[model samples]
Target: MTTEAKICQGPHTGGQGPSSLDELVARVAACGARPRIALAACAEAHALGALLDAMERGIAQPLLVGDMDQTARIAAELGRDISGIAAVHAPDPREAVQCAVDMVRRGEADVLMKGLVNTDVLLRRVLNRATGLPPKGVLSHVAVFELPASGGTTRLAMMTDAAVNIRPNLQRKLEIVHNAVAVARALGIARPRVAMLAATEKVILPAMPATLDAQIVARMAEQGEFGEADVAGPMALDIALSPDAAARKGVDHPVAGCADILVAPDIESGNILYKSLTILARADMASTMAGSSAPLVVTSRGDSERSKFCSIALAGYLALAARS
Candidate 1:
């Protein structure tokens, strides 16, 4: 049977959403459709390895746009066969990125993955007004983390704008929240709880600008601006995740302790928190650019093969969900 035929035969539950990365992959496996991924400048070993793994697991169908000889060499070095995969030769990195972006814009690909090219190069092509993927308002990065809880369990949490939109203003933050909530909903969180992070839980004028923005966002949430999502702001990091800390701090809000999403005040704090969770706490994460025409996988070069594969799974699932 053909790959598409086999995928169409997979079972569909349309039931509970995934709570962990493993479950997320399983959900994608059960989606009965494979998202077509276009990898820009796909000469990198780690990125190719992850895409190969994803293809083997039926999570993605990859279209490689790069130096085909280098891709074949890397695949051979990794002892993986790429005979069945499609390739578009664009030896120049910029050309490769533009080709990949054009594929997405033309609906030839469902997802976009960054490969050997620099991020700015890839993003510049993607943000090109005429030949790029048009933004749904603004482009932002959302990192989904599977963190270890108190017991021997793990929970999924999302952090936003860690890699994009440095120093976003109030309006931009609102757009970021909307982008994140869309991702959370795509992941099956019916009503995500959002925590706007700040140094303290108090809005001190002239000192903490983040607190002011957070307070305004929280009020907007109360006014039904963010749809079904629950949002709170001016929450310290400890109060955002720890119920015990919330209790001790006397923070009586719906999203104080159990926030499904954390919105950072700036890129520095967001990137630090994201890296801390990955490097210090040893959390597993999958990240993608939200608010794009299609799901975009932009994992860091320092990220593991597992991280890249999981990112493909996340993006694949989102692509399938968007189709549904």
Candidate 2:
């Protein structure tokens, strides 16, 4: 299990962040405690495979919530058993989501995961103030990617509001950046470099509203609005990721090429970039909704079991960090 040596958060603390599935599994084990996960719609066999793996690794103690028949059926098909696993009977998928959220609110679980349920159904349950787990801040998805580095090492980078917040305004972007900063801190990145991404590195308020938004956010960051992060704005992706390109373009900024967090201009760009990395660049990703009191693992239906497992581990890590 190879762990990426991440720049740890805070002035005195330093440690590594998980760079692979195996490494994340190990990090969760090193916590010496398992996060209780309320897994809604556990009937999905592929998701169950991931839950089973996390349980085997001692990172997750899941309360399987959904149609028991489906769960049992999938478990049997996989030649597995939920003998030690506790389950709640929620025949209706929507009701299953409520059941899972209630479990989290009741302190029976520290994390929530979406399984076979629809995204809207699951998110509605999380947003419902009466029965659902309302978030501490605005809900947004932050995806952490592990790209190949020198000596075959992996570098952990993050992109925010990718799966949520379409066409965010300046205020919404502030929340998004704050959420991403939390993820960076959880990954042990003290003062993570943040790049406010746009088409060009120059700001043209009328023609490019995104650059203006980026400029405002960068100024807010300069004023210590987002604590402990080096924020720079209106940077092209090339300048944000490639040091050589930054040098060639004479973009003299601390976060120009060494950015760990990228604030995309819009959800369209964010989602496209996320899928491109996952599918085209072959980058491994673990994503979840940030700003929730307890971590919420939300993977797409098309995501692989490895992705699900990684998401669970990431949520568990977030849970542990929150507790600390």
Candidate 3:
């Protein structure tokens, strides 16, 4: 969301990048156990297809929670075989969401994946006060992307409350950071460096409270607020991405160059930035709602097959990593 300088890579006008799906899948496979995942609204064509693919690859053991008859019909239409798959029938989407969440609460499923259901409906069950997977306020959305130019190593970036919190205050941002850091640790990142993004590197007057919040977050981290994570901020996007840009601008932050995570100011900026990267830049990404008792894969139905597959792997990774 920062008005930072545009980042340009060699010969690629639109964004060029390596997908993290393959890498994540490989990691899951190496764990030697197929993680159990529950699918909400599992009857959709894309949803069933992706679940089948994940099952066949041994990355996930899916507990399909939706209209079983409709799931079968969709699978049949999609030329998928549901012979060995286990499913729990829920006639309505709202019930389906609760079924999936219930599986997680009961330890029947390790992760939660949303299919054709509206995110709001599914989230209502997840955020239910008396009965839910985790506490009400801890849920946040995290997207992990691998840049093509960067090769091999996976880069972790986080945007908070993209699908949930509209405009978070300063205290809420701390929770967001904590949630993001937990996700980073799940991805095997040790001591992740968090860069709080703003429109500029310096905190300006009356323009962006985010800049000041970034500074405050950094100080909080210094005071042992966030364990094992280094936080720095009020940085523009370019400064976060390009080490050279930070040096040229006389910035001296640990996360200036090679930042592992970029925390956006608000939902508007975070959502817009994510969409820009996916639509305009052509970034291959997978997102999930995390910080709950179970990971929730909440990719849109419009997402590509690759995106869905990556999200499945991500959910499985978190599930497996949690065990370790």
Which candidate leads in lDDT?
Answer: 1
Q: What is the Å distance of residue 20 in model 1 from its true position?
A: 0.4
**Residue 10 accuracy (lDDT) in model 1:** 27
Tell me the spans in candidate 2 whose CA falls farther than 4 Å from its real position.
1-16, 19-21, 150-152
Best TM-score goes to which candidate? Answer: 1
Q: Kindly provide the TM-score of model 1 when superposed on the true structure, using C-alpha atoms.
A: 0.94
The residue pairs that clash in candidate 3, if any, are 17-148, 18-148
Sequence-dependent TM-score of model 2: 0.92
TM-score-wise, the better of 2 and 3 is: 2
TM-score winner between candidates 1 and 2: 1
Give the higher-lDDT candidate: 1 or 3.
1
**Clash count, predicted structure 1:** 0
What local lDDT score does residue 247 receive in model 3, on the 0 to 100 scale? 91
Cα lDDT tens digits for candidate 1, 247-311 = 99899988977999999999999999989988998888999999988899997887877888999
lDDT by residue for model 2 (165-281), tens: 989999989988998998888777878899999999889869899999999999999999988888999899999988899999999999987889988988899989888888898
Per-model RMSD to reference:
2.7, 4.3, 8.6
Task: State in Å the error of residue 251, model 1.
Answer: 0.9
For each candidate in turn, the TM-score is: 0.94, 0.92, 0.89
lDDT of 3 by residue, 294-324 (tens): 8888878667788888888888877766665
